[model samples]
Target: MRPARALIDLDALRHNYRLARRLGGGKALAVIKADAYGHGAVRCAQALEGEADGFAVAFLEEALALREAGIAAPILLLEGVLAADELPLVAEHDLWMVVHAPWQVEALARATLPRPLDVWLKLDSGMHRVGIDAEAYATTWQRLRALPQVGGLVKMTHFSRADEPDHERTREQIDTFAAVTAGLPGETSLCNSPALLAWPQARGDWARAGLMLYGASPFAHGHAAGAQLQPVMTLESQVIAVRDLPAGEPVGYGGTFVAPRPTRVGVVAMGYADGYPQFAATGTPVAIDGRPGRLIGRVSMDMLTVDLTDHPDAGVGSRVELWGRQVAATEVVARSQTSAYRLLCGVKRVPLVSVGG
Candidate 1:
């Protein structure tokens, strides 16, 4: 069996969800899209179903998978139906959907369903992504309201820069959403992980918990709220081999790192194939035998090399933490030049074992 595995602390996941709700002062939908950002959707949903206000996924298939797995909580389809043909299934499965573009609203107006679908009308609101333009937001809401197939409607928008905390752009986006949807009589969902953590004023009737639910801070810097998140997944492995190299010898592909002195390098059985970032630089952080260490070479597909010279007793079979507990995923993500969401979602080829649900 492979030595690498992801340890998912379901207790931490539940803790983060509760934190999001408390921070936003409203109901929170645990955003479990992309297989709970690759933490295994079925298992994650099972772990969270008991107390999650509901779960949110990117599309219909993900929602359907959860339903099949017996997740009876309200599930919102963040991207809505990809094609109009999916509307029937969306209706049949009792899925709520984000009706963003004109075609989705048009499809809703035309469809005759077994039941009215709960729809979230998404406003463009500075994200300039898949949403109805702000100028047309109210009219679109009215249009969806008139549809017999539409049941409850919620107003929603995504933040483009809430992670910055001090950025005026987030304020502008929030104002835009507020002004345009003024007088609209429906619940609002504006805060994602970052906004929920940083911008209290922007939190709406509902919050969407995504990256933070996995226990990684959404902000590049620290915050009181971000400090509350507990890491959920710990990617761990064992040292498979070690090399004693003299000063100036190059290491790994491209010889990106040259030994500055006599170096003891420990090889780890984890890499890009296991969802470790391939471009994570030589100085990236890792924890070997519960002590801090630094990666020392270009990451390989199935292995990476870490400097172990500081730990005289560490060698083959020493425990290595890629990210979790002793080594924060945020630190590794910052050093890798990637976001925590991407880092968490990129994990693959490693078995996931759960504890503390």
Candidate 2:
């Protein structure tokens, strides 16, 4: 064994979902897209199946996987049906779809399904990535409402700056959404993880909980509204080798880190291939046998070196925590100039162990 593994705490995942529901002030859709943000979709969904109001994924295949896994909870497709052909599966699986574009509206109008499908009409409040413009929203709503195959219709919008509490753009988007869907019927969903945590007023009939459900804060500044959500995944490995390098010796490819003094360096069995950031600068945090240490060199394909000068007892076979309760994924990404989401989703090849469901 490589001694490298990701320990997923399902209890922490459940707690985070509950926290989202508590703060959302309405039904909470646990967003499990991107394979539950790399925590293993089926496993996480199974753990949350009992308590989640619904499970949300980005595609129809993801929903199908959950269905195949025997997940009976309502599954919402965040990206909705990519093609008209998927509408059948949507109805068959009783999945909720986010009708963002005009094509989806037309598709729904054209399709003759065995049963009516639930849909969320996405409004392009601010984010230009998806959804229809405000002007097209009401008309699209009318079109979808007229469709015989459309069942429950929910008004939905995504936040462009929900993570930035101080930003005014989120407020603008919320106002735009309210104004556009003012007289329209059906439930509404506007809050993402950040909005659910920081902007209580953004909550509607349904809130989408994504990153926060995994216990990593979505905010760029602090924890999830300082909520006591536990981290779900702990990336762990062990020191495979140790060396005492004298001053003037360089370490790793490009010698990015030179020993300022005689230093004890410990080689960890995890690296970029295992989801560790490749450009993680020197001084990035790591935990050795539960004690703090700093990364000392560039992350290699299969190993990373950590400065263990302060830990005289740390050597080969010592436990190392890449990120977890001790070193948050947030902190690690901050130093790496990336994000916790990328780090989490980048995890592959490493074995995953689920715990505390």
Candidate 3:
């Protein structure tokens, strides 16, 4: 065995979900898209199946996988039907979907289905990515409302900068959403993980919990509410080899890090192949035998070196934590010049072990 594995704390997952529901001030759809941000969708869904209000995925296939796995909770297709041809499958699986574009609406109007499907009308409040324009929102809503396929409708929007708690754009988007859907008849779902944590005023009838549910703070800096999140994935490995290198010796590829002094470099059995960031700069945090350490040099595909000069007792076979409770994934993400979502979802080639469910 490689001695590299990701410890998944399902209890922490449940805690984060409850926290999202509490802070968002409504029922929440646990966003499990991208395989629960790469935590393994079926397993994550199973962990939350009992308590989750519902689950949301990026597309219909993801919803179908959940359905095949026997997840009976309401599943929403965030991206909705691709070509209206997916509508039959959507209805057959009792799936909900977000009708974001005009084409989606037209498709809904054209499709005859087994049963009426719950539809979420996404408004392009500020983010220009998708959704109906403000001017056309009401008309689009009317079109969808008149459709025999739509059983229920929910007003939805995405925040581009909710992670920045003090940003004015979030307020602007909130106002825009409120104004556009003022008289519309349906439940509202606006807040994502960051909005649910930072903008109370942006909270709607349902919150989409994503990154926060993985116990990683969405904000770049410390936040009062973000502090409550408990990291669910602990990426751990072991020191495979130890080197006592003299000063000025370069380590790893590109000679990126040179020993400032006599250094004890511990080779960890985890790397980019296992989803560790290849470009993670020197000084990225690592934990060795429960002691603080720093990653050194460029990361290799199968191994990464860590500074163990401070830990005289640390050597080969010492436990190493790439990121988890001890070394927060947020810190690793910040140092790696990546996002928590990417880092977590990028994890591969490593076995996942569930615990504390």
Residue 10, model 3, lDDT: 97
- Give the Å error, residue 159, model 1: 1.0
Give lDDT tens digits, candidate 2, residues 65-137.
Answer: 9999999999999899999999998998889999898888888888989999988989999999999999988
Tell how far residue 342 is off in model 2, in angstroms. Answer: 1.0
lDDT tens readout by residue for model 3, 243-353: 899999999999999999999999999999999999899999999999889999999999999999999998889999999999999999898989998999999999999
lDDT of 2 at 281: 92
Using all chains and alpha carbons, the TM-scores for the candidates as numbered come to 0.98, 0.98, 0.98
Q: lDDT (CA) for every model shown?
A: 0.92, 0.91, 0.94
* lDDT for each residue of candidate 1 in 1-357, tens digit (9 for 90 to 100): 779999999999989999999998989999999999988899999998888899999998899999999999999999999999999999888899998899988888888799999999999999987899988999999988988899999999998999999999999999999899999998999999999988989978999999999999988888898989999999999999998999999999999999999999999999999999999988889999999998988999999999999999998899999999888998998889788989999999999999895
| Model 1 worst lDDT run, 10 consecutive residues | 103-112
**To one decimal, what is the Cα RMSD in angstroms of model 3 from the true structure?**
0.9
Error of 1 at 64 (Å): 1.0
lDDT of 2: 0.91
- Backbone clash total for model 3 is 0
